[model samples]
Target: MKLFSLKKTFFLIIVLLGLTATSFAISNDALRQQLKLFSETLSYINANYIEVPDQKELIYGAIQGMLSSLDPHSAFMKPETYQDFQTDTRGEFGGLGIQIAVRDRVLTIIAPIEDTPAYEAGLKAGDRIIRVEGETTEGMSVMDAIKVLRGEPGTDVTITIWREGLNVGKDFTITRDIIKVNSVRSKRYGDIGYIRISNFNENTSRELRNELDKLEKKPIQGVVLDLRNNPGGLLSQAIEVASAFIEPGKLIVYTEGRTATRNELSARRFDDKDRDYPMVVLVNQGSASASEIVSGALQDYQRAIVMGTTTFGKASVQTVIPLSDGSGMRLTTAEYFTPKGRAIQDVGIVPDIKVRSGKVVSDESSMDRVSPSAVPEHLMSDSEELDSDNGAPEDDLQLLRALDVLKALNAFGGTYSRN
Candidate 1:
């Protein structure tokens, strides 16, 4: 029975090799040489290894290595990992609630989802996760790190993080919970409407439309769309968001890939005319993927004055192909481009007006003798006020800047109209 198992494995390997050779159009001689080398290496390891390795593990490792060599985003997802990934897209899952990626070969935090355990614990963007549960993450894949960080709710996971402007690495013990993301939040600043998007999920577009409808009830002079710390999600949601503001029949974004079937996603004519209000978009280094797509499209069309810092620049489109073993492959299948033909892969969207975030004021004298309760909530300093429910500080310097820009546009004879 053992001999038969080995023979079946050998046959499977040969069949896989033949398929690869045929797909790539490799010459018969070259294909034979490659297969011979692979067979010899397998035999040598099986015969001379100090400890026998599991055949399945060896094969999985090989597949992982191949995918990792292509790109950081492309990866082989084991069956369990694939299941967790599907759960994540539904907007509720048990985890740290931080979007992470392997940036510069380090496990880096892209953005912490708002109101989640990680965000409430003050885990900032660009923080490097050095250790998880005392185990080093030096050679760990993004998916592996995710597995360790996420588990049953009510569990605790300690992670050591190295951050900029810090002398020593800090360890944080975060309790996992079911993360439900509220993608859109809105506030009225007299005639200006401020909307903050935490992340793009399935409900993002609908939530944004609902918020916009509520804001439209009041007189709106201008709009500030904040995309700071927004680690992007579904591409379809991004398209829907952009369609809300952009004109019908306008090209929002186009993608190019090796195959023609999955390329080019253009904007559909969802409405008669675009929203004709002066607009400013706020973005920062944490804004990535779908966030970049929306901001890039608006900027290219001159529909909005993009403010704040540059974006995170994750412009590749990944497609998940399921395997027969219940596993799957998340492959970087295409590169997306803005309407003006600008590539945002590693080069992020540059803001029209660059404004750095202002420092939080902690001085008591700056309060201007008015009692905290007497002062209007929007007029109070962000540092002095905290959201009661989430305990997260509402420090939004970028939003303030966007409002200022909108006011300026409104003042100058309403020059920046959305035509």
Candidate 2:
């Protein structure tokens, strides 16, 4: 019996070795073939093309296609594109200062950053950018349009916009300026403290902390955190911000991926500031990435009342890997889950109070739009006629409703039982 067992062990070892060898050989062959195919395709495109395509554009397009094929978030970044990303994360850039994204192959305005040139020039969300400086934006990528938008401070750029609900398209000749995004905008509406966070960038946590601290000294009955039209940023910042409301040692988020170490981010002990305040978080289709982390964690832990539309449903974590050539890859590395082990990829967080804001041209009265607190039109969208206190006409109407919810919670004196 002993002899037979030893033979069986030896056979298993040999089989494992054979499998490893085969896998390694297959991987090498696959890589070689891919490289050869890339070379051939590039050569063919350059040698024979209708318009004599720019070599740099062709190379960048290939890289973008390669990454985009993996997932929507993973993307290639050239030097300028990478720089624009850095500026965005830093919460500052030079442009008309409008938040934009590509949807259906068109540049759609998500929102206008407060006090920016875009907001001042009457730019509104849902505006379709058709032409930039007389150049049609039909075949342009988001990064390409951004490059055209960004320029030296005080420069002017003409943007042709096809706005929804408008009788005729509008043209805005906006002068560029240095857009310094506060990232976190805070105020006191009656007894409720309201805070609007644009993104979870590197300085997000610190900015949020400062804002929270400012409200702590006041007799603020409740707080509203608005995270709408935020594309998300640093993961660490998300955890830090969530920890402010949740108790220590609570699981905030976790991530798992093939061949990646499973990571669990928990809320650590904070300084106990504003721990007893009733909190309401707002989110929408524009809230994603790190914003999802905060909203998901808060909702799962039952630490706050979430009021808004469904979140953006981006639960994948990306790592920006910088190469030697100043280019980088925003690669999706892992899928994140809330503390309840619920995957949010393609499934966004459901709000406790689901409210729908009115459209720009809807016949509904301003009273039909519900906000926890009274908000003026200028506080949200740039337009006067469409903008109303009910929070319609703004891209992030869900967040405004969340502020209203916080005001309601404040009126309840933090004594209402959460169901």
Q: Which candidate is the best by lDDT?
A: 1
> Model 2, which residues run further than 4 Å from truth?
1-37, 43-58, 162-170, 358-419
TM-score of 1: 0.88
Write candidate 2's Cα lDDT for 172-201 as tens digits.
999999878777868765556778888776
Decoy 2 TM-score against native: 0.73
Off by over 4 Å in 1: 1-4, 28-35, 269-274, 360-395, 414-419
lDDT of 2: 0.73
Compute the lDDT of residue 88 as modeled in candidate 1. 72
Residue-pair clashes per prediction, in order, are: 0, 2
At residue 28, what lDDT does model 1 achieve?
75
lDDT of each structure?
0.83, 0.73
Worst ten-residue run, lDDT, model 2?
380-389
Model 1 misses residue 362 by how many Å? 11
Q: What shift in Å separates residue 91 of candidate 1 from its native position after superposition? A: 1.5
Q: Tens digits of per-residue lDDT for model 1 on 264-361?
A: 66666544445788899999889998999999999988999999999888899888999888888889988989998999988989999898887455
For model 1, the local distance difference test gives 0.83
